[model samples]
Target: MDSFDSGGVRIAYIDVPAVGGSGDPVLLIHGFASNHAVNWVNTLWVRTLSQAGYRTVALDNRGHGESEKLYDPEAYGSEDMAGDAVGLLDHLGIGRADVMGYSMGGRIAAHIALDHPTRVRSALIGGLGMHLVEGRGLPAGIAEALEAPAGTPAPNPTAAAFRTFAEQTRSDLRALAACMRGSRQTLSRAEIAQIVVPVLVSVGTLDTVAGDGPGLAALMPNARALDLAGRDHSTAVGAKQHRDGVLAFLAARP
Candidate 1:
């Protein structure tokens, strides 16, 4: 992975060209507590896109993966992380590209599509849905779980899942805790409605954490939803259904 300075934070990223030749760029943002490799590479998303002739670029948000970690909660806002993503595109001289993000990264991608509309050709939001507008994101206790002592039990299943994932990824728990504390900003209904670019909102039908997929797509003018039947948040990211849906969406994007 390569590194770049984004608003004074060091962000790590990998830029992979399409197998045949240069192609339309696709910027990928991974979910919280997960990095480029775990969320995209290990999931075969990079390969999937590359084989389909789309250049894939993925980045580690400031506090995750090989990026510089920050402990200040204020530094982890979704908009701030969105800026890092835009900066990566600017660094690579890409003025616009297809952007995709999962879960928390979906929130950041939403910010990019909304706040920097000119830089986003299309947006693919995965593992997220109406929660991007209605809810605050994740849940309470996740930050606490990240900060708890190693043997301490989390207060709930969701928190425990996050804690276990952070541990599995060997994340900087304090940095992720601060990220959790600061990055839960949600978009309003009116704001979501203003995203005019082609958009695909996909979520697992069985997911409890992402709100309603069809409900969210209904709020956007040019967005549609894909239900990953029988999948949940944990299983949705790499599911074959998800990949197929995304490929179809990209193929049909204007």
Candidate 2:
């Protein structure tokens, strides 16, 4: 884990170099309530991308991992999050790079491509969609369940992991909810259409959070969709099929 000061906020990230040699840098952004290690590292994403001849850079988005978490709801806006990526690239002297983002990170990537086109060469968005501007369709009981404290000790690590991830996120749940709400109002198909970079829109077949994969793909002018058969949002991130599809897309890029 390396650290860099991006516009006064301390940012944490891991830079994984390609196997053969340095290649096009690919910045990775993880989802909500998860850190870079949890979302990407544990999923073999860095290894997969590096092996495919791409230098992978995964960052702990503010408020999620080792990065500083601002309590102010206003700080969690997509523009602010997108600026962090742009700031990181500027700090590192990277002019432009391909970017891949999942879930909330995917939303940030869209904003980055829309707002900072000169700094983005291409984009791969997963676990999310342009249609999800209003936020993922959360279940009715989810909000209540998330707010309530754990009643008993978890039996297994997987259960414990879920609790821990959830607890850590509760620190700024209101901010998170607000950010999701604001994202929908801030992002639009017209804005997305302005992005000229090549894009790959990927979603799990059972991903309820992102809505229809093809519907989201239709919003982008230069985009294509990749469906991970038989996989849900959580499982798709680590699935071999997902990695293979991403690699194929990256390889075909100019």
Candidate 3:
């Protein structure tokens, strides 16, 4: 584990080397409430990318994992999160890199691409879409579930994952909820079109969180879509189909 000061916040990260030799740097950003280890390393994402000759860096976002947690909802806004990624790059002396993110991380990646376009070479967004800004596309009961008490026990595997993620990150449920509400105000479908980098939008066929992958792909000028058949949100991360699709997309890019 390594730490860097990203705008006064201590950002935690892990850099994994490619198997054979160094390649274009790829930064992996985890979803909301998930740390670098849980979201990427534990899912074998580092190894998967390294095996394909890509150096990988996975960072724990502010308010999650070993990174500094600022309970202020204002600090957790998308702009701040995007700055953290750019900060990491500046600290590491990386001028540009490919970025891949899942869930909330995907949203942050979009901000990075749109706001800090020069720092991003390409983007891979998983488990999210522009529709989230609109209020009607999420899973049937997700909003209700998120609004439930922070300490409430989960009833199933999916819920269990969320609960565990929230607890592990020591996230302030109230602040996170506020941040979610605040994000809707800043997100825009028209802004998504401004990101000109090659993008790969992927989601499981059964993913409820992202709403629709094809819909998201259509919003980006240079984006491709992939569906991980038979897998849900959680299962798609390390699944063979998901990895193959992402790798194929990356390989096809110049």
Candidate 4:
């Protein structure tokens, strides 16, 4: 993995070239409590894209993975995180590229498409949907779960899941707590509508975390949704259907 400085924070990332040669670059953003390896590499997204002839660049959001962690809640806003992603493209001298993100990463990708339209050729939003506009983000209890004393049982199912996942990933509890609290900002309908770049909103049919995929996609002029049949939030990212949909979407995109 390589590293770069983004707005004073050191972000860790892996830049893999397409199998044959230079190919269209694609920036990958992982979800909350997940790093580039867990969400992308372990899921075979890097290999899939690379073999499909797309350059893949995946980053660890500030508080997650090998990147420097900040305890300040103000330091983890989606916009700030989005800046880190764009900075990577600038660092690589990429003028524009397709952006793909899941869950929290999906929100960050949307911010990139909205705030830096010129830098995004397309946007693939997975594991997130209408919630990006309607909901605040992960439940507040998730932050508390991350901050709970060691050995304390999580208060609820969602919290327990997050707590366990964070622990499994060996994340910085304090940094993840702040990130959960700070990065919950949701985009407005008008803001979603402003994103003109071609967008694919993919979500599992059984996912309760992400709202309605088609409903969210309908807000944009050039967006559509792909339903991952019978998949849930946790299983959706790595589903073969997801891989196929994304590959097809990427192939068909302008």
Ranking of all candidate structures by their lDDT, best first: 1, 4, 3, 2
Indicate the residue-level lDDT of 1 in model 1.
81
Q: Roughly what TM-score does model 1 have, to 2 decimal places?
A: 0.98
Please, what is the TM-score per model?
0.98, 0.86, 0.87, 0.98
lDDT score at residue 81, model 4, on the 0-100 scale: 95
lDDT string, candidate 2, 53-109, tens digits = 888898988766778755555667788888888888887778899989998888889
Q: Give the alpha-carbon lDDT of every model.
A: 0.94, 0.76, 0.78, 0.94
Off by over 4 Å in 3: 130-161, 168-186
lDDT of 4 by residue, 3-80 (tens): 999978999999999999999999999999999999999999999999999999999999999999999999999999
Q: Is candidate 2 or candidate 4 better by lDDT?
A: 4
Error of 4 at 162 (Å): 0.6
Flag regions of model 1 displaced more than 4 Å. Answer: none
Q: Please give, for residues 62-150, the per-residue lDDT of candidate 1 as tens digits.
A: 99999999999999999999999999999999999999999999999999999999999999999999899887446689999999999
Greater-TM-score candidate between 1 and 2:
1
User: What lDDT does candidate 3 reach at residue 102?
Assistant: 90
